[model samples]
Target chain A: MKTDRTPKIGFGIRKIILALVIPFIIVLIWLYATMYTSIPHGILPTIPEVGQTFVEMLKSGQMKEDILISISRVLKGYLISAVLGIFFGSLIGMYQPVKELLVPIITVIRQIPMIAWIPLIVLWCGIGETSKVVIIVLVAFFQILVNTQSGIESTPKGYIEVAKLYKLSRWKTFTKVYLPHAVPQILVGLRLGLGGSWMAVVAAELIAATSGIGYRMSSARSNMQSDVVIVCMIVVGIVGVLMDKGIGVIFAALTPWRKVENENRKEE
Target chain B: MKEAKDEIRENDNSYIINVEHLNKQFIVDKQPMEVLHDINLKIKKGEFITIVGHSGCGKSTLLKIMCGLVDYEDGIVERNGHAVVGPGPKCGMVFQDHRLLPWLKIKDNVGFGLKNLPKQEREEKVRKHLEMVGLKGFENSYPSQLSGGMSQRAAIARGLANNPTILLLDEPFGALDALTRIQMQKEILRIQEEEKTTMVMVTHDIDEAIYLGDRIVVMSARPGEIKEIIEVDKAESRKRSGAGFAAYKKRIYDYFFEDSDVEYDVEYVI
Candidate 1:
């Protein structure tokens, strides 16, 4: 009964309609530009041309292959970065010596752009899968690590003092106090790292890879198939949104206490 | 009250806690300043000792030292007949802020210090203490889900879950509103009676001190010296409107205003 009085924001079909308003306007603008303007088909594909190309790509299975290739690369790099980042982040965050030893070097290394490392990575590992994976790892690791580190480091001293009072071992303290406190923040890092890995893999493919959606886009660009390039861009955007939402759902499940806190704030 | 306290002392010469020449210093603005100076006190078993003082009076520091949460270089601070090197199961502490982990459910937070216990026993203890604190239905709730008084009740449950011989409270109810604080005070006395645990509470509220303490340790700030220790008979001091309560309040106010020209006693003319 106490929860009944709170004014709820729309999350029904109305909310979905509200969300789609901008996209609908964007499509309308695209339709108007393509139909009325004298812009060349190579520069900007007409609406019907884009729709036909999207249908053609869907029938050929080339689109599926390209999307699958890009997705798989993103997954591989994201998993590696998550594991290593959390491990080393926990270490560096917990221990002063580890932080002192790693942070300075990591800080300098993180400043180096992902694209700038492409030439060197491709030179060492060639324009193959290894270089792409390496590129994604280089891009994603710092995002995950830095976020995880700050999250772990920001655990309140009060909680640590409670852990100490209980006589918990270092590992126990980390697991019970620091880890739980940092879970939401770590998820934020993971989400950011996922986005970074996706971007990095695509960038790698554009520069050197013979596969993926990025490669498909670049190839389409070379052939002046602007409609196919637009299709690839749309797919990438949709996939990015899906990945973000998927992680968001998972993160929500992981920290149910946060939901409780929000409800408690309403009670207040 | 003096005769009763003396009788208890005679019955048990072994004090539960003994603090001798306790001196504590903290570096404030790059200068070593004394916070507690040559403090000495002895606490008997199952005694409720309330410390009343101004803010920054080192009463909290003194309580922390007794709990073995803080170290002292030059003083002897003993708990359960041993030197307080660090926090142990013999002593538990409740802070001003209810220091429950926000992520933990009430059950988990209360049972936090009971990690070494078997699972069933820990759950039983957690359940028992939660009921004792009147938070039985809130076992699954997070700390943030509870109101301020409820959070404090959970914190007290956490403190008592260890089954410590002594519980040290550093203004545990200071953050609560007036009505809730009074309610919690009554509940604390009931819990203390049931548990028979020795408690040392540092508070600024004189009424709370007088109502709860078997003996009140009045303290002055700056050097953080113990001004006086007044024994209270529960029957009289517990009655807030009674003459005995006013007498105790006046005595405490006089001690606070002794060196100053401020006439704390006021006559209201209507």
Candidate 2:
């Protein structure tokens, strides 16, 4: 009799294959459609043309410079936003008076779109990297702030009561009990905020940038170089995926309980 | 009991806790809701005492008061001849829920109350406690990964890791299913035998009280107070099928069922 399967192939690898299958099929269809169909070449850039364009951009060194500039701005903006968001969010979450005072203000500010802030940001910081960074920071800060506040507020009463029972120092309570309880929610907020900031940064750069990927896209649009624009868009998408994956990895590492549960479920 | 107190006073170091006329009340919507009223109890060193009552009998509140988690309206709780102020390293509590920090490993959760100890010493203490609790191999497992019984074991291990003078357990077995609860009880008995630490556990389950406790304090509901404290001398002889166990269970059940509002009190004991 043949031996049963070892079950050692791993579900994660299978999941990756499952995820890629449809996308790969779609790309194949696109290539075949380009080869056989009468659709205008201008409207549907062939797969190889897009690939060639991607390689060209990589060789020019222009893509690297643009990517670096965009990334640097995003880093600064995201860092500032993360610090401010956690600080204010915790403040509002902790004290009732502060929450009452600030909740309405935050609710109002959260409603305003990042694009709407463009004119005001331009007026205040001028149409430089500063304004783009400001836009990114503003977009990210509110999302994280709101999320952090909610996270802190939603911690179980049991945990806090336990902490109090132990007479844990205030700092220890915050670091050990409250922070750990609120981490998953805070991370969700951060992930959402990261995506929001990326979108806002690109928009801000497109409208007023002299350098970066957004600047390249704008310049490409002006010259009617749709291929370059598409290339830039793909880069943006790839970077977004990578950044999200990076955050996800960190989140999984931080919460091993979740990882174990997921692994168990997959086995089941 | 009076003579036992006199002997304890003569050798003050033997008694771990002395409670005198303890009372606690809460103001709920301007009404003075009394919880524990005119309570007096004493816990000897290296003894296991269980408090059994209905849900509203304030057994948990009494445990909290003893641990200094809540303030009493009147009376005094003394530990080692010193009036209780707040919770100290000498008293560790296990709640109905495990309350293990989800982010921490089993070892870290067990070691949480040992923040003041040196790192190596804390690790050793944690490992020793885990081994005693029969969770030696699962030190890195998270609370979420463990079964309900396992989690409670971890919580028990955490309580012991501090090397506390007393372990205050409030319905620690309540969350487990029947088989698991029985297994946990056996494990706790083994640990109690090994550690020889004082334990005061609160439960609504009479058979559990009889099985695990040297003395079971039966409590009355609403403005809660101790009705009677029964000493189970032949606890090992009082098995589930034994006549002694049945008699004690019936007595406690009849006392609670006297109110008529609690219909299943007798059924719960069986």
Computed on alpha carbons, the lDDT of every model, listed in order, comes to 0.90, 0.85
Q: Candidate 1 chain A, which ten residues in sequence have the lowest lDDT sum?
A: A1-10
What proportion of true contacts does candidate 1 retain? Answer: 0.65
- For all the predictions, what are the DockQ values? 0.70, 0.50
- Chain B TM-scores of the candidates: 0.94, 0.91
Instruction: Give one digit per residue, the lDDT tens place, for model 2 in B1-270.
Output: 658756865775677888899988988999989888888888888889999999988999999888888877589898767888888888989999999887789998898888777889988999999988889999888777888888899999888887888999999999899999988888888888888889999999888998888888999988899999887755543487777877777778777777673575546455
Score residue B166 of candidate 1 by CA lDDT.
93
TM-score of each predicted structure versus truth: 0.94, 0.87
The native-contact fractions of the candidates, in order shown, are: 0.65, 0.59
Superposition TM-score, candidate 1 onto the true structure:
0.94
Tens-place lDDT per residue, model 2, A1-268, is: 1223565366657779999999899999988889999977666678888889899999989899999999899988998999999888888877899999999988998889889999989999998879988998899999899888888898888888778866789778888887777778788889988888888888988988899899899998887677788899999999989999998999888877777767656655
Q: Can you list the residue pairs that collide in candidate 1?
A: none
